[model samples]
Structures are given as structure tokens and as C-alpha cells.
Target: MGYLKNIAIAVLALSLFTFVVLFGQLPALRKTPLGTLQRALCLHLPNGLRSVDSRVTGGNITSKSRRLGQYLFYEQNPVVLILFLFLLTGSAALFLWNALHRLPMSLIVPLPIVLIPPYWFTYLCATDTDHYITPANHQDRLRDYPYDHVLFRPGAICKTCNLVKPARSKHCSLCGHCVAKCDHHCPWVNNCLGRGNYSFFLALLLTLGVLQLYGAYLSYWILKPYLVTDATRSLPWREYLPELGDAMVEAVNMGGLSIAGVGLLAASTAALPLGLFAYHCYLIWAGMTTNETQKWADWRDDIADGGVFKTSREALLSHSRPRSPEGANGAASTGLAVHLGVTEEEPQVRWPISSAQVIVRTNDGRPPRGQETLWTQIWSLSDVDNLYDLGGWDNLMEVLNGR
Candidate 1:
């Protein structure tokens, strides 16, 4: 029982740590206590360890570990995807093998329904390559989303891919290509969850949560005979708590490792996927990707420091620059130019909603030199426009259509 308690506590601690690691850097939580903890863990702790390692081992340990970390994270590998499948399938098999016979027909009938989608969706997410932006499809990908002139703007090219970065698209070093409508490269799927497979990723998260919850319910059902007692309710208020604890331990002991241990893990770690799904829902609602959220957070920080400036495209154009031919010059060449440091070829996207406002972040916390009259310091994000957000409903519909 003590060992079971220890396992539960360990599982819970791991789940919480995973939650903080995954969510702490998000724009919505980057300023919160969770963010502080994440900085301490991911940033401060690594730096401190490097310092110690430098002193003790002449940086050899740090070099080796850094290489390993880089390979694990930066290289395109199936390690995480394999590990995820192993854990998921192993746990489901353990739970069902032990708890299936004892459960009622109602529970037994729903097991396959609950369990199958994660595997199906995970395969879709993992094996999907259609989202990977290639030279062949690069031209078409450019028309995917209009530049917001904030997080993403015209004329930015991915040096690695040697191609113009489409709006809302990003080059993934691990994936070895630019991904269309890039959200983030998810290691769990060994793929970039973007235009083609992002919807599948969403379904995987939802179904994974349902599977874990169902497994947890089955565990509870199997142990119900032992957990239930007249004494649990009959006992006095103060005594009832301890009695409930004893009953839980007894139930766990009765179920043993296959049922109890797997169930504990399922219940404890269920929040990771479910919580991630909720966050993605928010992202869709706001019409931003995981990549865009971080970009927005950086913009938010710059705005806070008064380094960000805003102006209309018309105003910038009127103040300066002559237009070149549409094909030879980029989209911004007509609206902005060399003065703004963006003169590369941009996609001639036929977007429904065009953004007039252009934003820039200055290192000096002032407007560009000599263009002071045209620029205005933007103090709030509300003053800016998000071109992708056609309200939440439309955004959701676009996501549902796998756009």
C-alpha cells in the first residue's frame, strides 16, 4: 500500500511537471507563476548546471549532454513517437487485460470506441507529409494565409529552406522543410502538425483523454466491491477521511499493479493531452498557431517596453518608395520598401481581408530614423489587427475544414 501510494505521488508529480513544461511558455501563461517555474527549470537550471560542469569537467559533460539534447530535439527522429505509442498501447493493454472481465457490458462495449481514435489519429499525425512545404508546393502554400504585418509580414525568407516563408508558415529544422500553416513540430507525433494533420492532432488529444478517463473508470469499477462500505458513510466526520484512505489503499492492493498502477498513471497523466487540446482550442479561437502565440508574446513584450511602432501601409508608401513590377518585386514592394528593410519577393495572395496597418519593433524604442511623422508608437495589441481571426466561429470552421 505504501508503495502504491508512492507510485501515485510520483505519477502525479511527473504529470504536474509535464504540464508546467508544456504550458509555461504559452503567451497566455508566460507571465504567470508557471512561467517563472519554467524559466527556473528550463533556463536557470541549465545555465547553473553548465556553470558547475564547466568548473568540474572542463565543460565536457555539458558538451556531450548538449549534443544529446540537440539530437533528441533538433534531429528528425521517431524516438518520441515510438515511446508515446509504447506507453499508450502498453498502458491500455495492461488496464484492459486486468479490468475488462470484471466490467459490465455497458463499459465493455465502449472500450474499442474510446480506445481506437488515438491510434488512428496518431498514425495520421505521425505519417503525414502533405503539410511539409516543398519547392514544388511552395508557390501554392504562399496563398494559405495573408500576412498580418505584425507577427508575420512580407519579404521574410527562410534561409535554410532557400524559399520565401509563406505567411503563418515556418521552416522546421527537424523536419528539414518549411511547413504550411506551421503550428509547431510535435515530437510526440514525429511530425510537424500543420495544414494537413493538425486536425488529426486535435482528435488525438481529445480521444487520448477519453481513453484514459475510460480506463480510470474501469479501474474504479473493478475495485468498487472493495471500495464500497457502509462504514464509509456511517463513520464520524473526522474518522471518515482516514477510513476512505484505508479503503482506497485496500482497493489498490486488491487490483495489484496491472490494474491499479496503470489506472493511477492514466488518471494522473490524462491532463497533459486534455489540457493541450484546450490550449489548441484557444489557439484556434484566437486564430493563431503555437508558433504564432510565441511570436505574439514577443510582440507583447516589445509593446510593453514601448519599442513597437505602427503605421498604415498607405502612409508608409506615400512617405517613400517607388513600386517595381509585381512579379519581380514582392507584395510589400508596392506598400513598403528598402527604407523599411523588406524588399524581397512576396506572394501575391488574393486575401479576403487586407491589413492596412503595419507594425515594426525598433531596438531604440523610437520610430525609424527620418520617418518619425508617419509612425506611431503602438501601446496596445487592440490597436492592431489579426487578419487570421475572422471571429471564433469562422476560425473554428476553417480548422475543421483542415485549412
Candidate 2:
């Protein structure tokens, strides 16, 4: 039943993909006003079908052109296409075979398959905001009917969400909740990186960016027009315009130019991922996340007090703060509170920082000028009669105790 369910889901996914790609979105490429006239005069072929002349709807040359192009390409391109299909099908089969045979599915297989597809599509169909394009003009209403007044702002943050929000907060529509310092929910990671997993998420994105750029380089070269005849190349854009008129000619020319321009456009698009990767790297070195970066930019003056490091140290120590609140022993809360917060932000001490720095700040701030005895502080802090001091690492226990 499990195997059957997987097969059913896979088939449904593939069928839906085919329907959407073949008949839904891609076919509209041929119905453009420019494409319509091109097909009328049989000037160029539509993308999927091959010939524009043959598929003419109104007994026009456009139909004939589409048909002719489709036929010519189909017959000639069969060998190349069949080889691609065979490889793709074979790979799928091999994957299924391993799965069915109870082979130890390594983490490697699903990682790339899951991560790359969404990322590739994200890059491929990216719009101005590095988000997926809304099909048709679905979101055009938001743009066309601009709200200039104060009432326009959709303040989605509720009271509960407001208090929990630290800095760089955003509401995830899919998750239907406000996340603290949210970056993006990544399916490949299989974990929503709010505050806990953010650093690792940044690292993953950096690694993916490198992998994708390398792949795009290889795919770009392979798609370069190697077998094009000069007849195809020599036909100037101007010459085609005279025969097909401005619109049809432009369509025909674009159809051809698109074949060549893909690599150049891809190279240009490469800059986005590269630039993002570099920006994040800079943030990591500066001990910041996307959230922190935004906050730093928004309130640069607040950092003047040198509170950032102090606050980070406080948050780091918050977890292990001594909880002996006026016990029977009444030991003068000899426990020193590390004032890590530099600025006035209340929860700034709860923010994330490196573990090493956390320990250092909690143990001793600016180790005493000469008597820099780390063990002295450790022994003092760990020396409660009823308490167990599981603090030292390995044989360092004797060394710390002796101090």
C-alpha cells in the first residue's frame, strides 16, 4: 500500500506538470498578438509544436508556418530528444528500483532532489522581489490600485505576535503565524528556521548558491547553438520585418534570438545569487543575521553605546543564571549577574550569539589584569555544598579543583 501510494502521488504530480506546461501556460506563448500574425503568414513555428504554419486556425499562412516548423523540427530533432527522454526515464527507473529493493537510501539522494528543484524554479521564475511571479495579473490589483493613505497599510501583526517579535520579524502567510526574525521557510531543510536554525539556514543558502552557479555554467554551454546554419544566422532582423511586418517579424526574430540569448541572460541572472551569497557572508563575519542587518541599518545610532556585544553575552548567560532565590542557606546571591545588554532593548540579551563568547562573558568579563585565573572563578562558582559541579572538560577537573 505504501508503494502504491507513492506511485499514485508521483503519477498525479507528473500529469499535473504536463497539463500545466503543455496546454495551460506555455501554449499561451503562441497566442500573443505578434505570434497570431506570424502564424497567419507562416513565418515561424510555435515553441512546443514545432511549426506555426500547420497549426493555423483561420486557414492562414500563420497556421502553415507553425505546422511546417513543427514538422521539420520534430523529424530532425527526434534523435536528440529521444536521447534526453531515455536518460530522464532511465534515471527515474533507477531511483525507483533502489527504493523498492530496500536499499539504504542515503541522505544524499533526497537532499539535492528536494533542494535543487524549488531553488532552480525560484531562480528561473524570480521576479523583482526574488519571489515567484504571480501568473496573469492576479496581483496587479495591488499595484494598479495603489493605496497612498495610512489606512492602506495592512498591519497583520496581532498583540500576541507583537510582543514575541524581536527584530526583523515577518508573518509567514503559509504558516499563518508571525515568526521571530523570519528568513524563509525552506522545504529542503524540513525545519522552519525562526531563531533557532537561522545561522545554519544562511550556511545552506550559501552552499546552494555555489552549487547552482556551477550547474548553470555547465547547462549554459551545452545549450549554445552549435549546429546552426548561416542561412538561419544571416537572416537579419530587418529583412524578416519587411516580409512579416513589425509584429510578426519581431515574434519570429525573438523566437530565434531566445535560443541564443538564454546563456547571456543566465550569466546576468548569476549575479543575483552571487551577490546575495556575498552579502550574507559579510553579515556572518559581522555576527549578524538578515534580521540583525535590517535592525542595524534602521537604528545605527543605538549601537553607539557598544551594547550589542554586552546584550549578546547577557542572553547567552540567561539560560544558566543561578536560580537559588533566597534558599534556607541565604547565601548572599554571590552569583554575579553578567550585564551583557549594552543598549536599552529589553530582550536584546535573549538574542543569539556564539557559544564561546557566551561562556567567556558568563565566566569572567575582561579577565582580571594580572590574576587571570579562570579556574578560580570556576571553582568559586561551582562550590555549593549540595550542588554538583559537572563543569570541567576531561582531566581539567583536577587542575580547576587545585586552583
Candidate 3:
């Protein structure tokens, strides 16, 4: 009973941490109560502690911890990847050691099939470098996706990589390279999930969910007798509640942590990967990436501020490209900060849909200088076209094909 109580408490704590860590950065969730808590934990709390440390210890404590924090979190490291694999392997080993012998051959036969894919896919996701944009492949990366004229534009250059920021590409500071078709950097794999390995990341999520569910099932198989009672459906609600509680306690006492605890852990946490997979699926359907969603969210917020202007690409192309954005330093009036390339030209790309819509963010929440007639103020995301979305099926193929 004490062991069960401890396990419950541990899982509850872990669930909260996982919720904050995984869902904190999502644009939709950032304004929720969870988001507020996340900011307090990841931002305000750390700053307050660091400030106190600086006063008490002449910044010595925080200075050292900050460097360690930078290395562990801000830099590209295998700490998270190792921890994920270690936990995954340890949980499976613990569950199998206790429950495998009790499982039937029918159930035992599928274990290898279910178990091997997560490891294989994780290897693929972690090691893939084909998505990394280099001078040798810069032109090729550029031709993969056409600039949507809304979210992505030509002429933006990454100061670090000194490479033209390709449509749908993003520079990952941790990886120290621009990634083509960049979604988001995933610490769980210690790599950027982009063109080359995004499909494998999806596979890893799927196999991981399946593996957890199957492990939980095997544990259930071993503890089924203790988990059930002769109490009938005719039992009152109060009686049934007590019966169910008693049955679960008996099951835990019989199976201990290996069977009951791992089972509960696996069953409860299976939603994490599956829910993430579903979110990714929705992104594909909408023709966006995790990185792009953040960008689009900023645009939406700016539009709400009446700071976003739309025009035809032809109208903008008619005028000479400016060496720099007119109000580069002044784009702070809008709630969002816009990054526009200085004196960039649109590159020719092979794509089914070519968009002519162009959008610009102004520092004054007004139209660009001497171009009032050519611009139209916009207020909604539906007005924007996502050229990357070729419908859900095509988007999935694009990911699978690594394009």
C-alpha cells in the first residue's frame, strides 16, 4: 500500500513536469494557466533565484550554474536523448522480466515486432543530417519549397550560417546549422526534426505509443485475476466504487512495481506521444510545422494589432528592393517582431501552386512609406495562403519523401 502510494505520487509529479516541459512553448497553450505556471517556473522563478544568488554569493553560485544550464539545455547535447532511451528500455525490461513468462505465445510473439521499431526509429531521427543546409546543398534546399509570400520570403540571410534562409527552413542554434523544411528541434532525439528525419520522428511516436500500450497489456494479463471481483453489475454505485478500489489495491500488492506500477506508468503516459502525433497530423493537414505555427501565430497577433499589411507580390516587385527594412528597429509597435530579409530576390522553384500575395509588418501599425495604395490592412489568418499545404495526404508524402 505504501509502495502504491509512493508510485502514485511520483507519477503525479512527473506528469506535471512533463506537461510544463512539453506543452509550455505551444502558442495556444502559452496564454493558459499552465502557460502562466510554466513562465513562473522557467522564467520568473529562475530569474528571482538568480538575482538572490547574485546578492548573497556575489553571483558566484548563479554564474557557475548558468554555464552548466547553458551547456545542458541551450546547447546541443545527448542528455535528454540518453535519459529518454534509458527510461524506455528500463521500463520495458522491468515489465517483461516480471510479466513475460505469464503471457501466452500469441501475445509473446508480437513483443519483438512492437519493441524494435522505437529503437530503430529513434536512431534514424537522432543521426539524420540530410536536412542540414550547407553551401554544397543550399541551392537544392531552396528549390524544395516555394516561398508562401506570407510566412516565408526570399532574401533573408542567416547571419551565422551565411546561407539564404530557404522557404520553410530555420537556423537551429543548438545544431549550429540551418535545417531545411525545419519543424522544430526535438531534445528527446537530440536533433532537429526536419526534412530528412521528420517521418522517422512520426514513426518513433507511433511505435512508442504502441510499445507502451502493449507493455501495459502484458502487465494486465499477469494481474487480471487480482484486478477483478465477483461483485455483480447490480451492486450500488457506492459498493462498486469500493470494490474497484479494493481490486486495484490487491492487484498492486500481488504484482508489485514491476507489473502494476509499470503498467500504470505505461498506460497513463501513453497519451503523451499519441497526442503529440495527433497534433503533428493536424499541422500536416493545415500545411504547417511546429516552427511555422509559432511564426503564423505572431502574424495573427500582429494582424489583430492592425499592424500587418497585405499586397500583391507584383506590386512590391515593381519597386526596387530596399537595402533594409524601413523600420527595422521600429517593428516593436506591433505585438510581434517581424524578420524581413534585406534586398532579397525571389528564387524560381518547381511547385504546383505559386502565390502572388505579399505581406509586410509596419513599425507604426500603418502602411509602408509612400506605398499607401498598394497595401491593404488585414485582420485574419484565413486571408493568408499556406502554399506548403497541398492537402493532408500530400503533406505526409512530402515529409516521407524528405522534401
Candidate 4:
């Protein structure tokens, strides 16, 4: 009973912590209680801790502690990756060792085989070095995608890299380099998922999810006979809470506790990767990256607040030209342009689809009023074209091909 209680407490606590860490900062949940709790945990709690530490150590400990926290959480480190691998390997090893003699040949053959792909793909993604954009290849990288003028615009340069920022590229502070078509940096893989490694990352997620579900199923299979043999003593299924306690006890008596625990862990954690994979699939279908989706969500909020306005893409493109005579530059040349009184540049890369509208934001809530035909008020995102979207099938191909 004590062991069961301890395990349950530990699992619940870990699940809660993971939930807060994962979904706390999501834009969709920003206004919800979960978001507020996340802010409190991430921001307010840290500040409070720092304040207490400052008082305790006369300000000696605050900065160091903050740096440690940043390095552990925000920066690239192998701690989480090591922990993930340890958990995966440890659980699988323990389960297989315990069940080796009892398990059938068919189950034994495929169990280890299922793990191979995720490990291989994870290694490939972690070691793949093709995503980084350097000064030597920055010119060629610019041709990968065109700026949509909403989330990404031409003429912007990365100050750190001192190169023209390509559409969908972002400078990863941890990597200290710009990655093309940057997805979020994943600490679990200890790698940045970008244009080069995104397919492998997806494959890793899918395979890992399968591995976890398989682990859970095997665990259940091993425990089922034991559970059935003790049916007279087993509590009713309708009373799940009490029945769970009885089940745990039966598992321990049958020498299946470790396997049962692994199943619980697998079942609990499997949802995370499967959910993430589904969300990424949605992003691929929508022709967006995680970064771009966040930007679009922000734009949607701004539009709702009446801070966003739009103009015809053709009207803006007419005044802008390629930045260089060589036609290699996508940035707009220095010249007065009508939209927002800022010079706009034509996209260097010829995108598959063209933007129907150019969207801009004003600091004040007032809409931009001018040539009514050119500058029209956009009420929603549907009013503008998603230049990245070439339909779901093509977008999936683009991600898979790493273009």
C-alpha cells in the first residue's frame, strides 16, 4: 500500500509538472487559467524565489541561480535528453528482462525491433548539420521561401549572423546560428528541428509513440492472467479508485509490479508525443511552422483589436523592386513606398502562391485610412491569402522533402 501510494504520488506530481511546462506558454491558452498558472509558476515564482535568495545571500546567489535555471531549461543541454533516454531504455530493459521467459516468440521478436527506428531517426535528427545557414550559403538560402509580409517581411537582417533573414528562418539563441524554416528547439532530442531534420523528428515522434503504446500493451498482457486468477478477490471495475488499489496489490503479489509501473508511465507519457505529432501534422497541413503559428495567433488577436490593416499586394509590389541588380537579393531597395510610408521589397524567391493582400499593424487602434481601393480594413485572417499553403498534400511533401 505504501509503495503504491508513493508511486501514485510520484507519477501524479511528474505529470502535473510536465503539463505545466508543456502547455503553460501556449498562445491559445494565454487567456485561460492554465496560462495564468503557468505565468505564475514561470515568472512570478522565479522572481519571488530570486527575491528570497537575494535577502538570504545579500544578492550573491540570485544571478547564479537564475543563470543555472536558464541553462537547465532555456538553453541547449543534454540533461533532458539523457533523462529521456534513460527512462526509455531503463523501462524497456526492465520489462523485457522480467518477462523474457514468460513472453511468446512473436512478442519477443517485434518488441526490440519497434525501438530501432525511433532511436535511429533520433540520432539522425540530432547529428544532422544541414539546417544551419552560414554567410557562405545565405544567398542560396534566401531562395528557399519568400516573405509573406505578415509574419515575415523582406529587408530584415539578423544582427547576430549579419545576414539577410530568410523567410521562416529564425536565429536560435542556444545554437547561436540561424536555422532555415525553424521549428521549435526540442530539448528531448537535444537538437533543433528545422528544414533539414524535421522529417526525422516527426518520424521519431511517431515511432516513440508507437513504442510507448506497445510497452503499455505488453505490460497489460502480462498482468491480465494474474488479474483474472485473482478475480474473486478483485474489486469491482465500477469502483475504479478502489479497484486500482486492488489491482496494484495483485500486480505486486504476482511479481508484475515493475511491468505495471512501466505501463502506467508509458500510458501517461504517450499522450504527449501523440498530441505533439498531431499538432505538427496540423501545422504541416495549414502550411505553417510552430513559430509562424504563434505569429499568426498574435496577428489574429491584433486584427480582433482593430490594430491590423491591409492593402492590395499588387499595389505595394508595384513600387518595390529587387534590392540588387544581380537579382540575387530579395530585400526592397531604398525608396519611398505608399503602404505605411515604408519602403517595401519584392520577394527574392518566387513562391508557389502569391499574397493577395499586404497586412500591417498600427500602434494605435485606428485603422489606416488612405486610398480606399488600395488600403482596406481586414477583419479576419480569411481576408488575406496564406502564401505558404500549397494545399495539404504539397505542404506535407515539402516538409518530407525538406525544401
Candidate 5:
């Protein structure tokens, strides 16, 4: 009973921690009560602790503590990856070992089949070198994606890499390099999911989700008979609540609790990856990346405040544009000035994919001046075009084909 209780407590605690850590900062949940609770717990609690430590140690201890925390979780460390591998392999091994006699060969055979793809993909994504955009290949990298003039505009430069930022490319601080079509850096794989490896990352999420759910089901199946048999005689319908509790206690005492606890843990943990996979699928359908979604949301907010205005893309491209200071090695000018709604006098480079509309921002909330093209007011996000969106099929194809 003591060991069972400890296992249950540990599983629940780990599940809660995993949930908060993974979904706490999600944009969709940011305004919800759960998000608020997460922020308070993850952000405010640590900040409050830092304040207390500052007063006690004159701020010396706070920075070190914060740095250590960042190094452990945020930086490209293998600690979380190792822990994830251990949890996955250990749990599967334990469950298979315990249930070997009871389970048929058919059930056991599929387990490894389902697990191998994600494991292989995770390794491939983690070690794949093609994702990294080096200064030497910066020119070729620029040709990958064109600035949509909405979420991504031309003329932006990666200060760290000192290269012209390609459309959809972003500098990953932890990786110390700009990644093309960059998604968020995943510490779980100890790698950045980008243009090169995003498909593998998605595949990893999908396969892992299936694996976790399958694990939970197998665990439940193994324990169900014991639980049912124990409950049948001891649990009475009249005192439903009390009898149910008694039945659970009896089952635990009879050694069914560990199996039940593991099932619950797997089910809870599976929710995270499944939810993330669903969200990413939606992003794919919408022809947006996770990074672009946040940018679009911000643009939506700016539109509501009347800070967003749009002009015809043809008008902007018709004029000559000078190369930005950052453009040295035949790189496009980093000063395209989407905010200005016009280009400076120089030769203009055509993007592979052209945006239908040129969207710009204003601080004073007034539309750009001196434009022959009609400056339409964007009241909502749907009014804008997602240049990246080739239909859903093509969008999915892009991911699968790693384009």
C-alpha cells in the first residue's frame, strides 16, 4: 500500500509538471483560467522566489539560480532527452515484463513496430545538419521562401548570423544560428525543428502520441480483469461511493494499483503530444507555422487598433529598391522597409512567391500617405491573404516532402 501510494503520487506529480511545462505558454490557452494559473505558478512563483532570494543574498544568488534553471531546461541540454528516453523505454520494458505471460504474442509484436519510427525520426531530426543556415550558404538559403510582406517581410537581417534573414527564417538563440522556416526549438529532442526537420518532428509527435495511448490501453487491459473481479463481490450498488473506494483500496492491496497508475500516467501524458499534434495539423491546414501564427495574432491585434493598412503588392514591387547596409554578399537588402509602404531607389529583386497585398504598420494609426493604389482597411485577419497557403493537400505535401 505504501509503495503503491508513492507510485501514484509520483505519477500524478510528474503528469502535472509535464502539463504545465508544455502547455503553460501556449497562445490558445493564454487567456484561459488554466493559462492564468500556469503563468502564476510557472512565472510568478519563480519571480517571487527570486525577489526573496535577492533580499536575503543581495541579488547574487538569484542570477545564478535562474541561469542554472535556464541551462537545465532551455538550453540545448540532453538531460530532458535522456529523461524522456528513460521514461519511454523503462515504462514499456516494465509493463511488457510484468504482462508477458498474460499478453499474447500479437499484442507484443506491434509495440516495437509503433515505437521505432518516432525513435528513428527523433534521432534523425536531432542530428540532421541541413537545418542550420550558415553564412557560407546564406545566398542559396535566401531563395527558399519569399517574404509574404505580411508575417514576414523582406530586408530583415539576423544580427547574430550577420546575414540577410530569409522569409520565415528566424535566429534560434540557443542554437546560435538562423534556421530556415524556423519553428520553436524543442529541448526534448535537443534540436530545432526547422525547414529541414519539421516533418520528422511532426512525425515524432504523431507516433509518440499513438505510442503513449497504446501503452495506456495495454496497461489498462492487463489490470482490468483484476479490478473488475475485485469490485464485483466487494462493491455494493446501495453504497456506491463508499463501495467504489473500498473496491479500489482492495485492488491496490491485491497488487493492481501499479498497473492502474501506469495506465493513468500514460493517458495523461499522451494528451500533451496529441494536443500538440492536432494544433500543428491545424497550423498546416491554415498554411502557417507555429512562429507565424503568433505573428499573425499580433497583426490581428494591431488591425483591431487601426494600426494595420494594406496596399497592392504590385505597386511596391514596381519601384526600385536600394540594397540595405546588411546586404553585402549578393544578399537582398535587409531594409525593404515594409513599414514605409515604398522602396528606396535601387534594383528590386523578385521573390519566388509574391504576396498579393503589401501590409504595413503605422504608429499614429493613420494609413500610409501618397499612394495611388487603394489603401484598404483591414478589419480582420481573414481579410488578409496567407501567401504560404497552397491548399490543404499541398500544404501537407510541403511538410511531407520537406519543402
Candidate 6:
């Protein structure tokens, strides 16, 4: 029953996640103009497969055929749908299986590969003005504005960096820098997925899928192949010396037998990446972000504020509800103490969730020293728990100090 319950949960989670990626997020991501780099990437594909080719290239039903093809690939390609389901589910299974094996988070590298689907989808879905504006057009637009004060440029603007955001660019508050064409923050990859290393991400995902799928395939009726092969080699020895030829010895031989294993491995490795890229191509046409497609609803808006949609502060407050101590379990007590460790001693952290402000105070009730990390300031001001526990405090120390 326990095993069955786990399996059921796994299936449900994969199904829910996949549904959101295909339906919810793709549509909104398509609004951005295509960038030159993205365009170049698309152009490298076969003419028959390119998104705009049906419109640009010549054919017998040139216009009509192109439109039909476009609709099929973008709106309703059966292969794409099937492949999407397989890849998404397979990727999830692989991740979960590895997680269950007690693998360390740092060593479980397959997640980087699985993470590619969403990032690629996000990139393909981006249709902002950055891709639409050309150098010539920028020159024309600049002709009308004062040269010194003109801030709006061709690319997306990075508000924090105070510079033009390139294709796939994103701002990371922790890093205090803007990434060009950012994919996502990946702890497993231990690097930001951006324009520079996107292809690598794709490669990694495909490789992971291959490795995982192969393992899955090996689990079903796998013993049969080994059993039959082992029987053939051991018959003479077993017949001659039944006492010595034990089941254990046969089992070891069977495990070691190579028997077309390399071929299977090769096929899996090749198929995994090819399959991912192909599915991603379809997602691009659909114009969806992985997060958007899976949920249809705003995750940031739906959950606690610090998630995908909400700003750091909004997420902290929106999700904060007083934890109940009535249960009185030992494990629960320990968890509660850890969660409230920084906050319990502080009082100044009680602030409105919507505000981007922080209340500064010292334990001794004196002003904090200058040149502190936001974390240090917050810790000094109030006795907060983890920095994430509150809304008004941007730095962790504010959360710890509760100021």
C-alpha cells in the first residue's frame, strides 16, 4: 500500500506539471519579438521544420500547405503532443527515482537536463520588442530624442542594472547582476541558464532523459534475458557438478553478461537529447513558458509571495500564517523551533506584507552601522527567523532580527 501510494502521487504530480506546461504558460510567452540569436538558431533547422518556413518557403499549396503545417506543428501536432507527454513524465520519473535512491542533491545531475524543457520553452516563447527592433530602427528612434537622457533602447531594459536587457536576460538580486537571456536559477547546475550556455542545457536534459529511460526499460522482464543466457552457459557445468553450480554463481554471471547492452545504451543516449529538442521545438511554436503552461493560473499570485510571480517581500507575507503548536509531536516541535529561531526573539518584524520597506533598529535600540549586508541590518533590528519568513525585510538578517 505504501509503495502504491507513492506511485500514485508520482503519476499525479507528473500529470499535473505536464498539463500546466503545455496549456498554461506557452501562450503568454509568445508575445515577445524574436531576437537575432534566436532567429539564427531557428534558421539552422531544416526548412520543413522551421516555424516561419511554412510562410516563407515555396510549396505546391505554398500558402495553404504552409498554414496547415503551421497549425499542425504549433496548434496540434500529434507527434509533438505524444513526445511531450513521454519526455515530461519520463524526466519526472527519473528525477524522483534518483531522489529516492538517497543521492546527494549536488550529485544528482539529471535535474539540469529536466530543467531544460521549461527554459527552452521560455526562450522560444519570448516575443518582446528587443527582437523586433533593429540597429537601423534604433538610429531612427534615437533621431527624435535627446542623446543625453534617452534611456529606452532596442532591447528590454534591466531596471536594476540600468542597462538594456539582452535576449533571454534576467536580473538576479542575490548576484546583483543582470544575466543576458536568463533561463532560471538552478542549484543542481550550480550556474545560471542564460544565452551563453543554453545549448549545453539542452544537451544535458536529453542526456539525462536517455540515461533514465534506459534504466526504466531495464526494470521490466530484464531478468528473463539474463536467466536464459546464463542457463545456456551453465548447463554443462551444472550437470557435471550440481553441488558447486549454485544459483548465486549463475546470478553473478548473468549480471556481468554484456549481450547487446552497449547498443541499448547508445540508442538511449542518442534518443534522449533528440527527443527533448524536438519537443521543445513544438513548445516554441505554441509560445509557452513551462511555469505558465503547467498552472494556467499565476503561481506567484496563487502561492506565498516569494514564488515565481510575487516579489520577495510579497511572497513572504502572503504565505505567512501562524503555525499551530497544538499537535505537540516531538518532530513537529523541533521543526517549529528551527523555523522560528530567528523571529521569536524579535518584535520589529511586524510590518505590512505589501510594503518594500524595512524597519531598522538595534538590540540596544541604537542605529545600525553603515556598510552592512541587508541581512546584517535586518538581524540587528529585530529577532527574526529565516529571512524568508517575513515580507517587509529584503535581507535575511531583517528576517532574523525581526526589524
Taking all chains together, each candidate's TM-score versus the true structure is 0.91, 0.29, 0.88, 0.85, 0.82, 0.28
TM-score rank order = 1, 3, 4, 5, 2, 6
Q: Looking at model 2, report the run of 10 residues with the lowest lDDT sum.
A: 381-390
- Measured on C-alpha atoms, candidate 1 has an lDDT of 0.82
Output the TM-score of candidate 4: 0.85
lDDT of each: 0.82, 0.35, 0.82, 0.77, 0.73, 0.37
Please write out the lDDT profile of model 6 over residues 213-284, one tens digit for every residue.
Answer: 544444322334443444456567646344233432443344332312322332334443455456554433
Candidate 3, residues 1-403: lDDT per residue as tens digits? Answer: 4555677688888888888877886888888998888888889998999889989998999989989878777899999999999999998898888787788899989989999999999999999999999999998888888877677867789999998899989999999999998998888999999988999999999999999998888888888887666772467878886676677788888988899889998988998998789988889888899899999889988988889888775555444333335333233322122233322355668777777787888889988766676679988988888888899898878877876
Report the lDDT tens digits of candidate 2 across residue range 1-403: 3433454467566544443332232122345654454454342323433444346544476566657755444332233334433543453344334332432345335436543553443332221121211233223322321111111112223453342222334555444445443555443332234443454444444545554454334333333333243444567876643333333233323423332232233333445445555655554444344443443343232223222212122332332234533232212112322222221122213212212221122222343222132212222211211111113242123122211
Per-residue lDDT of 1-403 in model 5, one digit per residue for the tens? 4555666688788877777766766767777886887988888988998889889998888888768879976788888888888988787777666766777787888977887887898898888767789978777777777667787766777888888788788899888889888888888898888887999988899899898888787876766555555455565677655555555566545534356556666787887888889888998998888888789878977998997877665444443233523223212212234443334332233333555677877787875443323356778888888888888888899889886
Model 6 Cα shift for residue 192 (angstroms): 2.3
Which runs in model 2 stand beyond 4 Å of their true positions? Answer: 1-158, 162-176, 184-193, 196-216, 219-259, 302-403
Backbone N/Cα/C clashes per model: 1, 31, 1, 1, 1, 43
- What is the TM-score of candidate 6? 0.28
Q: How many residue pairs in model 5 have overlapping backbones?
A: 1
Predicted structure 2: lDDT: 0.35
Query: What TM-score, to 2 decimals, does candidate 1 have?
Result: 0.91
Misplaced by over 4 Å in model 4 are 1-13, 59-62, 230-244, 317-350, 367-373
True lDDT of residue 192, candidate 2:
34
lDDT of 4 by residue, 168-284 (tens): 899998877899999888888887889899999999999999999998888877887665544545656666556666666777567554688778888878978887899789989
lDDT of 4: 0.77
Q: How many clashing pairs does model 2 include?
A: 31
